[model samples]
Target: MKNKRKILDWMLLIAWMILIFTMSNQPANISDSQSEGAIKVLLLIGIDANSIFGQLANFIVRKCAHFLEYMVLALLYINVAKHYFTKKVVIISTVAFVFTYACSDEIHQLFVQGREGAFRDVLIDTCGGVTLLLIRLGISSIKLLKLR
Candidate 1:
């Protein structure tokens, strides 16, 4: 049963990685429309998505999506890592792999038509993973304090 749980964990991680790859492989226009569609939904909520703000909204939504993708990726990764390593090892490995994957994902984008890789995006992605790391650390610290 424990072995099965580990397999399930890896399957989920692989599936999410595949999803991110597929999204990144989309053509530029399709990707833009995706973020724009999100803005449209926000527009329905009566938010000011005027022409100028629309541009800003698009940028924010796009960057947030990148942040959120790797954030969830890090969360899944740490879960699997905990099963195979010590606390310190898991923390180190989680950040290392998440950052590495983020770098590779951007490189992958460079090959995709209409997609250009940017270092800034990689930083944004790393920040997302770090956000999860920080949150998890805080929770662990609280737990330790309570136990003491």
Candidate 2:
């Protein structure tokens, strides 16, 4: 049973890495423009229509998808890490490391011709991680309550 989980964990980790690589290498023009424009429109209608708000909205719109993607990856990785490692420390350390790796990946995009890395995007990405973590935690708590 233990060995099975270990294998699954490694497999999941590998798949996650492949996804990260694919996302990094994906063509940006189509997705990027869609994200930017959608956010702009949402901001224009949702916010006060100020330029700053528009820009902020655009930024969030542009990066939120990536953030959500990372969040899912992180959650899955956490689950896999928990399976392979007995200690809570090991699982948490892996999450932190994975999160840092995500930050670095985004930073790497900055050097790409069409990509610009921003701290705000990292923050948004972290929010995604936290959001998913909270959701999963909530689900776990609910399950525990039911079990009790």
Candidate 3:
């Protein structure tokens, strides 16, 4: 049963990595079309739908994707790492691994037509990982206080 749980965890991690890679492989135009649909929904809610605002909305959606993908990656990494390492080591290693992967992911995008690797995207991804870690720590602290 324990082995089964471990296997499931690794499988989930690999599946998520594959999903991220497949999305990164998409060309900019294909990616933009998905974001444009979300922008249209925002417009329906009465946000500005002018050309400039639409472009800005697309940009936000893209960055948010980066943020959310890494956030989930970090959470999964934490869960896996906790099974193998002490808490302090798990936190440090998870951050390092997630940040490194984010950098590599952006570099992968550089080869895709109409896509250029940007360091800013890596930073955004790192922010997402760090934010999740902070939230986890906060919740743990709250639980400790309640126990006392």
Candidate 4:
């Protein structure tokens, strides 16, 4: 049963990484269009996506994309790590994996036409990973408190 669960967790983690890679592999124009699609969704909610706000909308959408992808990546990695590692080891392993992959994803972007790798994006990605990890830890801590 444990083995099956671990296998599932790993499968999810790998699938997510592949999805991230696929998104990053898109040319800059395609990527921008995707972001624009997201903004159109926001427009439905009455968010003005024009003028200076247009630029801001694009910036927010792009950065949030970076943050969310890695956030989910961290959650999946942590799910797998918890099955195979002690608490201390899980933290170290998740951070290491998330940071390394974030760096690699940016490096991969460099090869894509009209796309440039940014150290800032890597940092944002790592921050997302850390954010999710901290949230997980907080929830765990609360569970422990409840058990006491």
- Specify the highest-lDDT model's number: 4
Superior candidate under lDDT, 2 versus 3: 3
The residue-by-residue lDDT of candidate 2 on 1-148, one tens digit each, is 8888778877887788787766665556755676766665767786543355655655556566767777777777776767647546654665586568678877777766677666776777667776777777788789999998
User: How well is each residue in 6-60 modelled by candidate 1, as lDDT tens digits?
Assistant: 9988999999999999999998999999998988887788765656474588888
Scored by lDDT, model 4 comes in at: 0.92
| Stretches of candidate 4 exceeding 4 Å from the true structure | 49-52
Rank order (by lDDT, best first): 4, 1, 3, 2
Flag regions of model 3 displaced more than 4 Å.
Answer: 41-54
TM-score of each: 0.92, 0.68, 0.91, 0.94
Residue 49 CA displacement from its true place in model 1, Å? 5.1
Instruction: Indicate whether candidate 1 or candidate 3 has the larger TM-score.
Output: 1
Q: Kindly provide the TM-score of model 3 when superposed on the true structure, using C-alpha atoms.
A: 0.91
What do the candidate models score in CA lDDT, each in turn?
0.90, 0.69, 0.88, 0.92
Off by over 4 Å in 2: 27-30, 33-61
Highest TM-score against the true fold, candidate: 4
> Root-mean-square deviation of each candidate, in angstroms?
1.7, 4.6, 2.1, 1.4
Clashes of 2: 0
Q: Which pairs clash (backbone N, Cα, C closer than 3 Å) in model 1?
A: none
